[model samples]
Target: MTDKVTINIPVQYEAIAFKTKALGFDMPSDLQTGSLLKTLVASKPGGRILELGTGTGLATSWILSGMDNHASLVSVDNNELLINVAKEQLKDNRIEFICGDGYEWIAAYKGASFDLIFADAMPGKYDLFEETFALLKTGGIYFIDDMLPQPNWPEGHAQRVEAFITMLEKRTDLVLTPLNWSTGIIIVTKTSNKI
Candidate 1:
């Protein structure tokens, strides 16, 4: 009963998966997932949000579009190339960009939980559940993308992903939902009223 996620894509699979799907070529995250994120922020107006693995600032833009004026976002990424793209794509003061492994920074952050969290940096064997739950406030939202057919993922990772899901379901104060779209994102809601 372990969870697992795959991150590898075969050429034949890529053909159908990325063919004519998003602004030409292929978008890592689909519009449906992006729009869902935006909607989450809009509904949770004024919420503090965190974007993990901000690739090229695409998701960052969507989060901004979904959030209200009072809300802010902190985006993290280890890729300098993507960070540069994010810098050019975003001009808002509310959005702060950080370049590094999310797990390292998260280890030092324990002040308060964020309202919304988007996890996109699924480095091999870097399941950030500990850091994610630690920073998530009660009633906050946590979204983890890329849980299916992990493009180039190591073997048995998909099983690990599933195990996490099973474990998530066992938590009493959290709600979990596995989306059936683009890579099967996991949505979790913390409701313990805790710090």
Candidate 2:
């Protein structure tokens, strides 16, 4: 069997990838991760999705591809230049791109809770972990990548990854499964509002 992932890729993916490369942004989500995000978004029809990192909108394209017409996405990133690349390529009424700090956005967002959240940035994934998780509705899906070691990982990042995994394992309000594929993903489902 072929090990490659075969799915209907987003039309804007190639352009976004090219812009990301041209801009020298090295942290875009991998193809495998994008595939998973697309699949996960498909599961939530008319869902309100949140993407914590809009790195050239690589993952955003995949998420948008999976969303139904009634669904909407709010993608955030701190870099204006990188986010602009995504805004230029993926033009859909369903998407709202925010060029701002993911951490601050999470803290200040008082809108409806999200059905699915893709935390590819440090805010939702590392910095304000619980606070961001709190934004997930009951039974909502929380997705994050980069759990595995990568060439770009800074020193002591492996230790941080281990610690994050340990913390997730101890959370009783949610159920999580760690996948070794696709840059090492961790998919979590919120079971309760309580921590």
Candidate 3:
């Protein structure tokens, strides 16, 4: 027999995963990504966390699991149906769910900066790159996944991903590490207020 190691799954994960599948939602954060999100979140006690895509709250559950009681999370998604699944499954006083265009939300947001940002959607990651980055507190982590090629990617997406990596590489205000693991992750920490 072979030994196996399993990451701790959040309480709401199974239910959310079941519902996500029932609803035919194909894009949910994998376990590897979720584990990393949880670890990153635990680093910031009472931190303010932002999640740009609440896909069935799969990642949300993980983020919440790592958060202390005083920590708060704001999750946004444009799809009402998908986000509603998240809202229904994950009930925590620390979480605030917003159903609207992520790009619009980022543009209009005028609140305290976040300690960690998980940009799972296109708005904060591919669009409004500079604007969204400004919301991150210095030393705060900016995490993104799905960086490697995937089956769901559309035509020309690879080039776009390459371009995005190049752009991130040129930034001088932040330090970034591109991990080849877990759907390809890029963990960036803002080192200055230069934006």
Best by TM-score: 2
Superposed by TM-score, candidate 2 places the C-alpha of residue 81 at a distance from the truth, in angstroms, of: 0.7
Task: Tell me the tens digit of each residue's lDDT in model 3 across 1-195.
Answer: 521216588988999999999999988999889989999999999999999999889999999999999999999999999999889988889999999999899999999999999999999999998999999999999999999999899999999999999999998999999999878999999999873
Backbone steric clashes in candidate 3, count: 0
Q: Model-by-model lDDT, in order? A: 0.71, 0.91, 0.93
State how far residue 144 of model 2 sits from its true place (Å): 0.5
lDDT of 1 by residue, 110-181 (tens): 655689988877631147576677677888888877777766667897787778677777888788888877
| TM-scores for the candidates | 0.79, 0.97, 0.96
Backbone clashes per model, in order?
A: 24, 0, 0
By lDDT, the better pick of 2 and 3 is 3
Quote model 1's TM-score: 0.79
lDDT of 2 at 146: 92
Write candidate 2's Cα lDDT for 1-195 as tens digits: 754766687888888888888888889898888888888999999999999989899999999999999999999999999989889998999999999988789899999999999988899998999889989999999998999899999999999999999999998999999999878999999999987
Q: Which stretches of candidate 1 lie over 4 Å from their true place?
A: 1-27, 123-126, 193-195
Query: Distance from true position, residue 147, model 1, in Å?
Result: 1.8
